[model samples]
Target: MISTRKKLLAASIAALLSQAGMNSLQAQEVIDEMVVTTVRMSEPLLVETDPRKPRQPLPAHDGADFLKTIPGFSVIRKGGADGDPVFRGMAGSRLSLQVDGESVLGGCGHRMDPPTAYIFPEAFESIQVIKGPQSVQHGPGNAAGVVKFERNRTRVTEPTVAIHTSALGASFGRHDEVLDASYKTPEFTVRAIGTNAAQNNYKDGDGTEVHSNYQRWSTQLSAAWTPTDTQFYEITAGRSDGEAAYADRGMDGSLFEREHYGFKGSIDNVSTLVSNIEFQYYYQYIDHVMDNYSLRTRPAGVTERAMNPDRETRGGKFAVTLQPFAGLTWVMGMDAQGNKHSDRSSMNMAMTDYRNLLRKRDAEFSQTGAFTEVSWDYNTTQTLSAGVRADRWSAKDHRSMVMLTHMMTLPNPTTGMKRDDTLTSAFVRLESQLGDMPGTVYVGVGHNERFPDYWELISKESAATTSAFNSTDPEKLTQLDAGYIYNRGNLRGSFSVFYNEIKDYILIDSAFRKPAAMMGMTRVATIARNVDARSWGAEADFTYGFADNWRAELTLASVRGENKTDNRTLAQLPPLEARLGVHYDNQTWSFGTLLRAIGSQDRVDIGRGNIAGQDFSATNSANVLSINAGWKPAARWMVTAGVDNALDKTYAEHISRAGTDVAGYTQIARVNEPGRTLWMKAQFTF
Candidate 1:
């Protein structure tokens, strides 16, 4: 039956492509499709191919799952899912993720959500990835990088509605479903989206059933009122819930819930010399529960092993845009947020006996800032752009917990402290046309300042070394960014280089006495001090269209990290990576193949060894291959099929489930990448 289906689909695609007159072509590579544009910049830019959106349907899993297609981008391979994004050797808090305009801090001290899991990628219209410290408007501590997911209001001239649905059946009982729709009219517009997905525990290509089963769902409804041409109003509300199994951590995320509400209005087409003015307010609440035996039952007598944490945030921003001259624009905004976090644990899943271990921990952070960008167009040959921003931010942290009528001594000068931070950043870019090649030559430079978050400042521990919490400070980072872009009618590419230095680099030293003192943990009595360090890397992306129906994309990247104190390789720096892909697309059919290669890395920091490092010297690399084909059976409908990891490669990623201690052998324990797998999908638009 499967063979028949494949043949039918292939024939349909070929027919469509042939009818579209796309038959004659040379061999070319296929790349992911992603368009990147920021609110601060006038033009749009594309991240590397890997950093771009995958060409295939997103797994409908989580935010991170949608990002794996880009080159130089890899995740710590745990078991089934929740693989965190690791970019050029940086992971964890080093990389920051924002949804809409808010941050969803993960509950696992080890970071389960990694921000990616908390977002529904299909719900957003665009995603922007900014490498290095080029922009500080999204909050501080982006020494590694920043990812922003955004959804823009949809506008259409006529009344219409659209719906899309797809499903997948694979080995290990994996299945998924998605439903999204939008309605538009002259006076009002409405949109709604929902999804349901589950997997009954998957087995490695070796046929080992990983206890990685999971189920998740989300729903959103939004409405906008544009009664007139000069003004508009919108209201949006959404809810998300899910749970995933965890093999690497002691606790599995048994319950995850998110609630979001927002309201905004804008004044436009005005005669007050104001280009645009907008007012907005947003509120979100997250409730997370993690337990050791929730998904996979634990042994008897295991009394207290779960963390129930709930976080709430309320914030609002008011922004204004002005265009005083023909080629200049300025955007200024002020925003403030208040948040509270509380945590409590118990022995059983049911609430039989409760303890007053935690009442409610409170924290507040606020920011006020102004930004402006000026651009000048010198005829059609040259253009220049410059921008700068300054901000004042303040935050407070406090914890008052009394357990069993016993008062635990808050570590260190537990007395809270406060500081006022002022940050300034700027950037410059110039572009000019190149002869008759239809290409543009460009150069850009930027700098930014960031402040430490409440968690990074106080959470501390040294599992390998004995370090007391006497001295620890916020991190300060500075980066130098440079890049050039070139484009022709059929070929395009860009290269970027970055150098970032930090003072008080957070180093994890487990060898010290009372190790477990190098981390961001509050309940545990440990210390994570700050040292100096440096990180630098280079990345390049290119795409070439050799023929009308064929094209290819190539990407290459590398990163190096050093601990200034001891001058050693930073643990878990991503290994060198390269990606090559080719795709052929015609009017009726499309086909593509992608090849990814990873280099061997042996850098080690025993004390800071994450899951994948315990056995391997942080060095394991392999080649992965994937192929796909799509056909248009008729107008408004399409069918697609593909195979992932065609070779069933058995390689362990530095942060994958392949790295573990299973049958007692000193196994590298890297979770096996999905073996040879096949999938088919069909879509119809109305």
Candidate 2:
């Protein structure tokens, strides 16, 4: 249900903008413009989203939502908030994620709070995506590449005070506000930022209500000192809290609180051997609460259930850039992390107080890694690069999962012990300019090793004769990343393809169905097992400037994964998809529209997938259209508005699970996308 208060707020925002009358203003807009239409290919297969210039229609609510605009990226939406990002066919920890160069992890075992869930995209500077396992600089086990939300601090030229603020309102009682302010001088600086966003449940194309609703807020403070041109030290502290409702799951997130603290220092031209050196240390904490009563009504037969989970992570990194020769560059770094996951719950299944309950640590994980990358410039036409990294990981299970099958207490099957692994990754690539062709072609291959995360380790029902946690081994990923960038005249295009061969690929087989008679409650539990898998995929993003005031942007993505052990296709693999856009821009205004089409996925292994979600037959191919316009009559303020899914078509993503179950309905669990909605926003920079 749409909240009345939010509706009033939306009305106020609309009136405020309408009263401005920007359409007739003749003032020239001189503010820095952010582009929602397209992003230039910064590097081969690396895409950067301009946070200020967001695209129209369905604006991103979180980090994962924002990533969907890029090719080869998708989100498994369980609700309006905290969606998990999927790249190609990889999800979860397979994709390395960093915010402000800090690594953070979620505490929910069911993935109600993913890493991206903690990020408010509008408050960040930029988002970058590196497709495929082409490099090891970010982190280890990045078989699906890396995504980074960066906030860069610029050196103060003089004493300055800057502020940026924006507000948004939309249908379904959606409201968002953001503010960032910084004061700087040559010697020191301080910055403060905050964001608030909320939305109510939405209806599908059929006008059926969905359970997705959320309200979230975040704030951060930073202080830095710069005594010299080549040296600087900064400290950042932040805290965030939120609540969300999910239609796909039985429970909702009532409390999503997180805290972060980080310290960073950098020095340039330290010595001839060391060109640059930087160090970072960060501490992150996640305290999450999931229940059935806060955001949704409890069903008659269902007991009011609630869970409180916590995760603490501390990590640090030290890197050095070296220039031993004029044409050679080397970057070497080491990173380490220590993590602890625990939870407290009330067995009474009421609105129980978490503070009154005793906390139990379920698992502990730790990692240490070292990496070195080198690039050699033989000439202006050719260059060679290579990198290698190694990591040591360990995990310990402390949960007491004593078997109580059929009302009998049996010995714990999980063995509740520790496991350790040593993994290594490396890559090499060659690049050369295509002479006279106005394009660059590059090819590279890499090997990545990823240790099993918490889901695979402590979330399983142990066996009597064997331990599922111990049987699982580190996943070995060997892949090739290659593409070319072509820029000639007004047309610019880039295409990339990747192939991967995985050994000891961990596949989750959730085909096991335990009857209530045997387990006292019916449950569909996932079982982790090893499999041999091979995958290949390709995606391309292109832009062409044509006509007097027009430009076109196109994107295409596809992937195929197969399990050799079971001789079946990989589960949760999305089908081919395409997005095309056209835009018209004038000196003070701009407008655009986009067409999105999703292909039906026929190659799927039912009842198998990672922690993201399993594929269901309810998925259907669909086509959607949306359009938006913008007005920027003054440099201090600008306004943008758009409608997404104007056709109000009903469709479900292939990676989504079945919605709330309904008797006698086959697709009862298929969570449908939101229906036709309207929204508008105004941004300010001064």
Candidate 3:
């Protein structure tokens, strides 16, 4: 009877396929648009935009800066650059970030260098964002969402040379330059890119200087060979280095160096059943150094200290897409990655040198995953999509001792321990077109089980154990997402909402204190613990073209989280925010203004948060206004200028890090945003 039922189901599917016309699968070409102010949602649960376009309030120097322009995104600012990105109040490993299909990890134990630090936004052609865990084609442990920085591949029919370059000058001694050059023929192509950005200390609205400054540079080279229109192979190499001063910590990053190498290839039209196959392999290394003397002056009676940490990662992926019949598609893939972390430090830089010491390996991690996704367009008005993925995660602890203070140390309880977990994730979604109103609505539910990352396991201790390596439990998340999009005559808009229930959620507590006898002193100790949590959020944006050359846009985002176990507000969550913009554009010039408002956040769980930092106190509401103008002087040549913080309002974001006392700077409650800044940019193409 089971076999007969299976046969009948197969017959019904075959009949449905017969009714739908069969055609060869082909790639769709997408044209990149220049987004000036705000990036609107192009579709339900997704956003695609060109990274090269110049936007108001100064162009982005890194990935986090660019992502903040979109709704439902915020940054945990540490200094002038290298801020961590937060989406929908979730941060750290929950948000999966990939650069050209490769995973990169930071080396800083305190998160001075996030994965987005090494990313130069203008070097990439496009940025794609997938909200919620609605798909599993990427790697595992993406309980929040996924962000991808991708480059476009173009087949050259004839010999060609193209160059796109830009330069910028801004207040506070800020300057930036970028160059992208490519040479292509029918058989092969070569491309090179370079970027430089630097800024000095900036003052707040009160004209008080903050200890924030940075300088960064990067270079990349790539070569691609194409044998046919549908087949291509590419190899890429890059390096980046920088230094930054922070106002939120005792130490500043003196060296942030990164090295990358990758290889990728793809083939299409392999057979009737298979449409395409793709593969990629990548290697990344990060070497970081932090000190109190390099970027700032040592305080009186304070010994000079420095630390060096590094991480090495190797990963690869292989995927294949198959079209078994008309209106049916399947994508299957496997990905694997491994990373090792090591560190060396000098308590007194003048007495002992860290460079001569051998680094000690602390933790190592590895993960292998397999995923399959299917999409079936059963009819013209409706479609169904679903995906399933399984991952095997393993971790090893190499620490032999744990330090409670500068002079106190004890044997590590979880030394030489190993843990493994096999987790599963899946999601299903259905979409339907609203009759003939040029609108679409969809709903989805996803379940993701996430293993603890290195920071969560090795950087902090468990509630009962000296080490969290073997005690931290994996996080399980079940989320429901729904959205609607409409595009008609003169107005376009989109709204997306999500609700999540997380079990065994890893929560960091900075207020935990160990017994004075155990620590040899009385002090707070950061620890990780599991708890139940729930969060819900919504993001909406609308744009209307009122005149031939005038348009207005409004965007709103808000999220609320609760610790169900403790019955308290979740820590480090961003408050409600809104942005309003008006723009006028014609063939020769364009002008725009942006108004941003942030609601006051009274709910707080002070001294508790994630690996980045804990919340300090409740935040007050604030508002800021900015304006920009652009002109086209000649063909392929353009110029733009803008003034940010026009009113010079002294304010700090709700998610900003607390300010620390520096030797030569005034200490505030939190790191303040830049005030009354002016910038100009020039771009040209050849």
Candidate 4:
């Protein structure tokens, strides 16, 4: 007899194929747009841009790099690539990141591979950023915001083939190759994508080489079947692998392997009351390995050590849209996700002992959620929108014992213990057009209750307990968001602000110490604790077209946080930053320059931060200049070249992790940014 999981999987695939036709018809109406040099607000609290388009400061190498180009975003650099993304002073699970309607998680205990690590920017069609907790449509626990990377399905009335390819070469032995090809017909469509990127160790402004080198590759295949104009179905599969050397940790990532599968479908005109229905299911698996001897030389007198961790995730979503009344629309949906994590390790490298050992299950998690959102056009110039969501979250501790050290072990206090919580989140917003002006304004308020994540529960210990699994409390947040967008003639700009008050906020303290033993020996331990916190910030951007084919743009962002429980500044917050750009563009050629300035940050709460890293010290101000140019030699071919960090300014971001000593690498106070670098890219479409 077929199992229930197998039956569900088969049904999902069949349904996806039946709905492929509707998505293909919609794709036929899209028009290819030009390259985007700068992204701007598309709607209140929303920003959208094409990920395939080339941008300044060199093309992105990963998802985190691309996000850093947006305002109110930062990266916690671990190496030359695979950095973790931070938005609005929040990291980890606070921000919801989805790719093609699927949530992919990392398998590293130290966050060497964030969700963005497996993402290749150029492989996606569009990237959408919904700032603040202004909507509850995606998933649960998105207290900060939501980011979605989507791919559009294409359908053709006649047999057609499309191909897009690009090559990039830059300083420090860096090179990349990307290819996207597709074949489409009235009956079916198939697409394939592949990417390869690698780089040698890069030097800081002082010409000192850092232990940051990496190589990565990925491939994906997708197919869609369209039976009719109102039905569409699709399936996708992909895999990726990579290795990265980090300067902030004792070990380097030797392997990052990922496998993913997805099925989706949509049906239009389902009924008179229900206008549309959509459903999707996805499965993802990650196998990660890290060691001290793979990328860097093992330190003398130190035993070679390696660790392998893996995670499996499965999830699905279903939704329906209804036109209940004139000028009013409603969308209702439900989603469910489950994940499991396991680990294996070895103290010796020569024997490859870890490969022969069985993986020990450490944690399991699951969540089921339902949501409804509504939009109403109150008048021609005014609109109202609201959404509410509830999620049932469950977690289980699978560890039988905890290891205080290689020689010390203790019985797990929460072994086989399961915890469950029902969390609620909601948001409401109102938007209105300025009278007699080409401008729009909006205001919103949101409340979110977020359950503790794996890192907070199983990875760290409590202040006095063996594990934080049962000690840390869920976080409750209330935030106010407001923004304005203005567009008139050749001038356009946007400004947004947010304020947040949090109760029982989860905080990580990396300096916690165990009591001294008989020999008066103290050991440091990282712990998780709950605290009250508040934060506020603002982001603004403006652009003006001056002389013909000339434009000037300015963008600014800053955020501040306070730990009310401790009466100190919140740790790991990014400092004030601004960017100014001048550009001249004609149909055939373009030239641009960017000036980036970051202000000094003095507020600090050292040894405390998020799961990824902690604040070491205050950071100093820095400024850098860069220039780029692009030329279209033919209708289907384009070339772009640029110089980043033109002034060779040696600097590191305030949120970066502190550097650790490593063999064959110079140790620094913090992982520094790349020095002066040159890069070039060529793209072709056929």
Per-model TM-score, in order, reads 0.83, 0.91, 0.94, 0.94
Residue-by-residue lDDT tens digits, candidate 3, 137-226: 888888989989999899989999989999999999999999999999989999999999999998888888988899999999999999
Better of 2 and 3 by TM-score: 3
**TM-score of model 4 relative to the true fold?**
0.94
Task: Tell me model 3's lDDT, rounded to 2 decimals.
Answer: 0.87
Candidate 2 lDDT trough over 10 residues, lowest sum: 25-34
Count of clashing residue pairs in every prediction: 47, 5, 0, 10
Q: What local distance difference test score does each model get?
A: 0.61, 0.80, 0.87, 0.87
State which candidate, 1 or 3, has the greater TM-score.
Answer: 3
Clashing pairs in 4: 16-233, 19-231, 19-232, 19-233, 20-232, 20-233, 21-226, 21-231, 21-232, 22-231
Estimate the TM-score for candidate 2.
Answer: 0.91
Candidate 4 C-alpha lDDT tens digits along 310-333:
999999999999988777889999
Q: Best candidate, lDDT-wise? A: 3
Q: Which stretches of candidate 1 lie over 4 Å from their true place?
A: 1-60, 136-141, 347-359, 362-368, 375-381, 400-420, 431-438, 462-471, 509-511, 515-526, 609-616, 657-668
For 422-518, candidate 1 gives per-residue lDDT tens digits of 7666666676664443345555566555554444443443332221222445456666666655543455566666777777766544344431324
Q: Kindly report which residue stretches of model 3 are placed more than 4 angstroms away from their true locations once superposed.
A: 1-35, 518-522
lDDT for predicted candidate 1 compared with the true structure: 0.61
Better of 1 and 2 by TM-score: 2
